[model samples]
Target: MDFTSLSLAYPWEQLPYALFAIILAFTIHEFAHAYVAYKFGDPTAYQQGRVTLNPVAHLDLFGFILIILAGIGWAKPVPVNRYYFKNPRLAGVLVSLAGPLSNLLLAFLCFPLLLLADQFGLGYKGIIELLFMIIKINIVLFIFNLIPLPPLDGYRIIEDLVSNRTRAKMSQYEQYGIFIFLLIFLIPPLNKLLLGPLFQYLVPAIYRALDTFWSLFL
Candidate 1:
């Protein structure tokens, strides 16, 4: 969960870019949830003003502080009343998928800008660095939130897919899920197992794909 694990060298110098990227990523992510839920006949989040782009509506104070200090954080979850949906299971899955997919979309949109900056040698190192950070952070958010564990969008998707009895069994251990999530990162072997493929293979592969695709135009 540490941003430093993303190999962001010069932590202090990159802090501003990281903060900006985090805010954008978290805001768009949460807004997507709210928007999709509203469209699916759940106005719960929209009624609470969660559908807006304002970061204030989405940023959780403690999570924001944790992210600033420790590089791990989260936003306030958008409230959705599944009872309003005609198909609660399908709507729930889409609502959960919305947040992570928004992040991936952000990364996809930003990749071209990063490529353009590199192609033109913009000379504005700060701008180039900011774009890079945005792309990287959004990609990280997209992948991280999709990990099938409790408190993540992936788990919500799973909950929607599973039978009621299975979901009830999952709920029995829901309270301890966050603790287990943290333990995975805190334990060295587990951390390596989780992050190794993500950083070594998936991330680089994504970047290469983006590069190849964007190189066609830029």
Candidate 2:
């Protein structure tokens, strides 16, 4: 999606902060997936070294560029083998949820730090901006990946919830899902109409949750 629709004002000075935030968020997200998969008996991701916090291990070159420019992107998907799980469906669902859940948890964990930065004005301008960007971008990544589209973590969750027949039908369209996402995202009216509300509500709501937590102590 275009950055404009998301109202992502990327000033030149803020690029470094934004870039760091994306890398940190993406790394944690993918690592969570790999870690959960390994715990659930899938050794593939762990064996491939995906269960680490290294951003380079998870960043997809094109996806990272898109995240910098367009406000939404992906990382390398952690590989999971159904055969490894005792209950494949449950394991799959938990593994899929891990990525976005990790982002949400990270955002929550950053709330106090964000409040401290605002209250005490800790660090220089870029440092403060980086902290805020970390919270916002992690929230965005969490919500965006839960859109129930193929190749996204959400779809795997959806797959577990649906009937076998429906799952088969949805699987058939998986290959074309990214193209469909691009078609909707690149078009102005469609992007604004569809994703705009998500930005307006979903994002602010998350921050508000963090705010509510901060209010308890502040």
Top model number, lDDT? 1
Q: State the local distance difference test value for candidate 1.
A: 0.87
Candidate 1 per-residue C-alpha lDDT over 1-218 given as tens digits, one digit per residue, 9 for 90 to 100:
77556543238788899889999999999999999999999989999999999999999999987777655778999999999999999999999999999998998888888877877887477878999888888887888898888899988999999999999999999889878888886676887897768767877787788878877888
The most accurate candidate by TM-score is 2
Model 2 lDDT tens row, 89-159: 99989999999999999988888887888788776765568888899989988998898877788888999
Task: List per-prediction Cα lDDT, in the order shown.
Answer: 0.87, 0.86
Candidate 1 Cα outliers beyond 4 Å, as residue runs? 1-10, 123-125, 187-189
Worst ten-residue run, lDDT, model 2? 1-10
| True-vs-predicted CA distance for residue 22, candidate 1, Å | 0.5
